[model samples]
Target: METRYDFVIVGSGVSGGYLAGLLVKSGAKCLLLEAGKSLNPKSFPLSPMDLHTQSSWGGGVEFSRQGNLSLYRAKCLGGGSVVSQALVDRVDNEILEDWAEITEVEAFKPSNFSNYYDTVEAVLRPYEIPRDAWNRNAEIYLKGFEREEYYWKPVKRAAHDCQDSAKSSDCIVCLGGCPRDSKYNSLTRSILPAIQAGLEVQSEVEVQTFQEKQDHVEISARDKNGALTHYQTHHLVLAAGSFGTTEILLRSGLKKYLPALGTNVSCHPQFVSFGMFEEIVDAHRMAFSAVTSNDSKLRRLGVKMDSIGIDPVFVSMLLPGARKSLLKNLAHYRNLASISVSLRDESNGNLSLDRSGRLQFDKPTAPKDRHRIQQGLNLSRNFLLAAGAKSLLPKTQIFGLYLAGGCSLGTDLKTSVVSPQFKLHGSQRVSVTDASLFPSAPGTYPSLTIMATTQLAYEHLRKPV
Candidate 1:
């Protein structure tokens, strides 16, 4: 095995892919690794009839601590960006300023990150949806909410070639992976560019642990053949998603020295309010995440809605789908369903591991947050009713465990696991650039933030390496 590399990046999702691109462009030798398969968007299916085993929800790794079943996520090359709703809202300038001030890291400048955001969006080819293409469900949602003068606005999404399909929802196959290839997965955009830069990214290579040594860090992983392989490097960047990064670190036994390491892991708690409409509200017509509510009241309530779709597995998971009445109710999926409420919750959660270094999550939400869930439920119920929904069965897809803060940045180690630039507590050449390094859970989607932070960290990496 090649025992040395100039830079080692763990996880090829948002952060890792972006950072790998930067390093490769800088002419640095870097190795990118992920514990997933590479998917071809062209291979995905087109209609609701296009699902089964190899399900995004089947045998997928889930990290919920709430006792709720694990939610589906990408175990593929592009990471969640391939499976995401593709919602890319900029970080609120106020939120950015506050985190930088608190962490004493002036580099969190909104302008710096904003430029990165624009670059990424242009690369992804983001665009809004046309009204006529909205799934019938989404159309009903618009009518119902509009009647109430609700302040919901069309959501900005990353997509292409939105062909109107009377048989398919706008983002009908979004979670299964975008069939139209309109969705931006890192494999095609970020990872491809990084690969073009001559950076090497190997799939099925799982990093086991790391040991700090003389002027270098030794890393080990299991290759495609399941044999242990070690790679040494002067620099290491961990852009693994929240769960992957935490699991790797906990396995490395570094969390013992870094107490705050896996403690406060959380994610955006999402709940779906099933609006069973009377018309074939083709909820799958527009891009996933095509609209969002502007009511700060819901924000104040800690509940929010975004453009979303419903396939049966998710429908079974998040809606009252198992109930016979709900099943009978769902028979009208052709005319039923509209929008999903992807809540940005303020719940505290934690990450833990077994002696074997296997990962787990556990976080019981408080009543306050629960109240917000109820409030949103009520609003969704009202809308579904207004839209002529016979019955609105609201369910939660999120385990209410939107994991965050595992390696927060702050002025002192007691308050954080890493510095503002994402250097770990006791290491110079090791850095974390993914969601795990987020100072807090971003109110909206995290892809853009992950990309920006990677740019910032890679700039630092380019300086010395």
Candidate 2:
């Protein structure tokens, strides 16, 4: 007989980690399943000096499907949080309003989630961006936002002892797997607490499918050898980001119940703004996404600014193939600097299970979404100019790690994958508690917003204390 759990969570990132923590604390029987391998803090490589191309954080990924693109995400243990910019920007009020308007649902107000935001901030120790934390490149961009009256707030970062990391863009490891263990990925903080609370957390178990049977879900998964593994749960939660979550649903044939499961996906189109300066900036000497342009400016122009660390891989992105030639720039690596402008993209894309149940990008970028990218480009260029950048161009597509949205939610069941209450409409036992549920993508960093709303989701489904 397969052992059963009261709740089985798919994915162990922010939503899963936080939700698991909550459920476990409240005495709920929970089983958290992540598609990726588990990572232990002690065994983690935290320094950029110890990283390589296949590093878990920014290292390459192996897509489960054939003909599907393998994008980079920290697949080990912590998920993308293992190697993502520890940014904690909240959803702008206007954007939140826009989300409700489009979703045609109520209750995603900024104020409503204020306390939730405060709670997460306190736990993560999201620090304020000191003025000194700004690299020359970031400072120049900050000045531009100031002059333009774009609602720029110094971004909050999720970490402790990040001062040194902030000084140099060398915080690359945090994006791939912090070499210094400075970042506070959700697994270390949230999931760990859940485990301490006696929650049974299993790793290396990849969930392939699940079924609804009256009052429970029969989840089928695999062991490391691809052997069949099974889990039973009275309730289910899918926080597997947007991409991973929807893939499981489709493979389980649950996508048939909701026509819009793979539609309305969004990702920020990010590109770097490089500058040739008289001095070595070596911005990569520390943290990433510490300083950011104001949300107002970001929303109007459709792009947000993130302070960056100037490292070699980053150097590779900034001036591709300029490694050996960078001795001249190295003298100015301390002076040379750059910023990443992630556009709040309007274009919605799609992810589908190809015939083999593997994920594939349908390339269904509508004209409006295309237009949003253009707007972001124009705004990014102008922002760079404002920052006194001598050169500016986008530098990515290798990993194609733009924030993609899937399994979107709204009040209209026909148009969205879930309802406004954050419940998977067609599935009685499932709920989507990740970034995939956003109606219109927030016009800036989305970590805080996703978490805040996730808290609301738990509140919605939580059994009374």
Candidate 3:
């Protein structure tokens, strides 16, 4: 006899974990399922290599079908929040307006959406990186921005009591996982509390598929021990990020009913450029990205630039050239500073399962997207040159962490997977509330928005339909 839950939420990432907390607080019996293992602050990987390999899907090294871009997504208990820098930023009003226009959901507009943003911010308690804590890498970026006369601002992060000095190197280790517990990830801020309030959690259980019966939703998954298990829930919530959720849906044969089950994919493709400086920048000693570009022109062009600090392993992979030249470039690792250009792509892609039931995506860099990337690169090169960089190493590859869309929200069933109510188009009890609901790219740091949208989805779920 399986105990049926009020809600069985799959993928305890940002959205699933947070939504489970809300449901349990409302006295709903919820079961949260995560494919990854639960890890505490002390158990988090300390080195970048270990962190990348242990904490993410495919050892943080999955590539696109075209092999032109690298894709990384967290597979840990708290998902990306555990591995990300936790940069908290809201979508721009213009971008929200565009979303509202696309989805025909007025709630997406700034006037209505701000409430959700306000609620999530109150919970996350994000703070801007103060100037006093800026490192030499940040100083160099700031100097470049000033010299280039481009508007810039400090990054806001969902962290508290971080080390004040840039020399601590504590921030570098945070890329793996924050040992100090200062970062407000879902495991600490939401999922743990939900568990305390009687929310059941099943980590290391990979959901294979689900079925929506007349009365209840049935879930089939494989436990960590490779045993098949089944669960029953009154309502099914899929928060398995973009790829995970889409893969599940495609595998379930829902694509036959929903024409857009795995379409309209958008990832903010990022290209990293390195600048060799005369002085030892030691960018990895401080925050990963303490400053972000705020140039209105760049924003209008759907481009963003930011100062970045990455571990030596990632630096070596991102740097151009090979063999002796690569080793020669690596010798100046201590003096290299990096900047990343992220483009809000206009082109959309699709996701499908290959013959072996493996996830496959066709996301090519469109000409428009390529133009934006080139523009960003040109500006970045100028900034580095102005900052006194002797030589530049352009990015050898493009990568993206902000994967979004597939089960997008809209009123039209012909083109969308999820309805405006957050329910799957053809399923009454199945819902999706994650980055999978993004109709298009928000052109900004998406973590804060993903959480805020989950808050909005909770409100919708609590109401009588």
- The candidate maximizing TM-score is 3
Point out the higher-scoring one by TM-score: 1 or 2. 1
Q: Pick the candidate with the highest lDDT.
A: 3
List candidate 3 segments past 4 Å from native.
none
Tens digits of per-residue lDDT for model 3, 23-116: 8998888899999889888899988888888888997788889887888899989888888888889989988998898888888999999998
lDDT of 3: 0.88
- lDDT string for model 2 (261-336, tens) is 8887666655555565555555665445456765653456666666666465455543544546555544555555
How do all the candidates rank in terms of lDDT, highest first? 3, 1, 2
Candidate 1 residue 140 Cα shift, in angstroms, is 1.7
Supply the global lDDT for candidate 1. Answer: 0.69
| lDDT (10s digit) by residue, model 1, range 1-465 | 475778999988777876777788778888898876666677654544443324333354364655553555556666667667676667677778877776787777776667767767766666666665555566667767877667787766666665644445345567657777766656667678788778887887878888877698888899768999888898888877787787778888887788888766657777677665555665645544456777767666556676566676556655544678667756777665755665565666677796665677776767876777677777877777877887665565554323456777775877688876678887888888888877766777777777777777776778784
CA lDDT for candidate 2: 0.67
lDDT of each: 0.69, 0.67, 0.88
